[model samples]
Target: MTGPLLQTHALRAHYGDFQALFGVDIALSQGETVAIIGANGAGKTTLLRSIAGVLRNEPGAVRFDGADIGALAADAVVKLGLTMVPEGRRLFPSLSVEENLLIGAQGRKAPGYWTLKTVYALFPILAEKRRVPGTSLSGGQQQMVAIGRALMSNPRVLLCDELSLGLAPVVIRDIYAALPQIRDSGASVIVVEQDIGQAMKVADRVYCLMEGRVTLSGPPADLSRDAIHDAYFGTAA
Candidate 1:
């Protein structure tokens, strides 16, 4: 793939008459992990929603595999190998862990890699509680289920929203530890995060958003803390 696997060109989003994103542009290349960081309500989640096809926009705005998919619906986007682990772990309380995983693959357009066995291997705890209701697991364990559910689709690009929302430091660590394995499994990732340190650690490239636009974007190693601080808050660190 000479070009990016996914690209957003001047993407904008609105809710009723209130706009949340302002001509945002971003990209994800094959097998790379890119992190989007910002404060609360910085349009980070909105960006993910737009790319994942939860929020519709112009067809030219979102290009996946060099094709316009911005006009597609959420389910349609997933069929094209783009899946999102939404901000909240909206697991079905009635479904067992394994059942939840199976639901994700129910609408599979084409299979590439992931399966029940592989998902269990990534989060061993899930295997032990495969028969348990999804809601009965620990926070980290539940998070694993959410991720595993998305992976079951065998997406070409995975979008993770607010991965470490409200968990203990150790739990957050455990969940993030699975990122490399996810990427290595042949799926590129775009993660929206609040923990700057954790995001910087896992991502090859980072984008700092403010209000509704990207303020700064570059490799994590190439950006200074102060620079990121400025982009994140629109002022001095």
Candidate 2:
């Protein structure tokens, strides 16, 4: 196996004294897609936030590309080639479709496989709506813009939080259809999702979380439906 591109060791996080993450340790290697699956309030988002530097952890708690980034600020993390497609497809409503994508490349430096033209190629619908306001597009289109915006950053590791929420199955498929291309662009990914089947489809490995702790983790084919159900709901059927 390749060396880890990102890692956490005894990582803990909190929202003003209420602990949300309980010493979670996970790793992602270069060019691998790992999924963090769980129900609501399982601290999956917290884990992502911690890694992205939105929620602070002790120095050396989180490491990326052989260096410690736990104490770095969010923008600093982005500058170091780590970016997140946050939940809810948070785009700048006032910005045009093209403008939203450009913002993602603001702090980027390294020459990468993702650029405005390349991103447009990945989501051709966005190319057609290039001049439209980001919010003016439909929900599925907005989600496409969100993912594309993240791609513009040319990150070494992409952290996605709930990419399938609040979308039709067809729209979800449309969004996931881009994952293969995303992997080809030379960025590993960590997807935090509630959609088990969808996660299984795209992830090389899966980590099941419940109440801020890792319950089950392995290759998707190695995990049985019964085991996943138990890990997700905390009960066996």
Candidate 3:
């Protein structure tokens, strides 16, 4: 790869003594979408956290846009154009819809595409509920806000942790529908998902992790069903 927008070279993360990621290496090109799929405790969230600078790694381990950001704090990483939409739709209950979205732009430096008006355009329902508290919206709506908030940063790389976590299938479909537009904004995306079908739908490539390590990875169409099953569950069908 010629200077990937984001690259993790033998990245590892730990919470005190409990290690989460084990020499996980991944890369994302500009405007590409990669999905990371695995069962619970596969370290998907840890990878995202590491990349977004929520968790520290060894120096020179995580390079974003050719800069070493492994030691940067989460806020500093966001300023460098990397952001994550956490697994749960963690929106502020006291903040209104628009307020929550604006908060995402707080540390923004590089200008790409997303903005308050563009976010509203992406999710019209948000415009209608601009005055409502973020938590007052329906589950599906809250998820939309989370995605929109991440976009508000105008990131070069967007890390989405479980975009379809608890929503209905129809809502999931609606959320996935916006992915193409997101990619069109010139931002690479990393989606961590348990729903294989949904992940394959939006991803150009997929990586399967097991017990804190990557066990399988390839283009979605090239990965066999059996391989995916094994990687997801750590067993053959």
Worst ten-residue run, lDDT, model 2?
A: 1-10
Q: Each candidate's TM vs. the true structure?
A: 0.97, 0.97, 0.97
Give the Cα lDDT of each candidate.
0.92, 0.92, 0.91
Model 3 ranges with Cα > 4 A deviation? none
Per-residue alpha-carbon lDDT of candidate 2 for residues 113-216, written as tens digits (9 for 90 to 100): 99989998999999999999999999999989989988888998999999989989999999999999999999999999999999999999999989988889
Error of 1 at 128 (Å): 0.7
Question: How well is each residue in 1-237 modelled by candidate 3, as lDDT tens digits?
Answer: 377888899988899999988899898888889999999989999999999888888998899888888999999999988889998989999999999998888868557678888999999999999999999999999999999999999988889999888889999998988998999888899999999998888888899999889999988999999989988998844
Off-target runs (Cα >4 Å) in candidate 1 are none
Across 35-122, the per-residue lDDT of candidate 1 in tens digits comes to 9999999999999999989999986999999899999999999999999998888999999999999988975657667999999998
If both were scored by TM-score, which would come out higher, candidate 1 or candidate 3? 1
User: Top TM-score: which candidate number?
Assistant: 1
The TM-score of predicted model 2 comes to 0.97
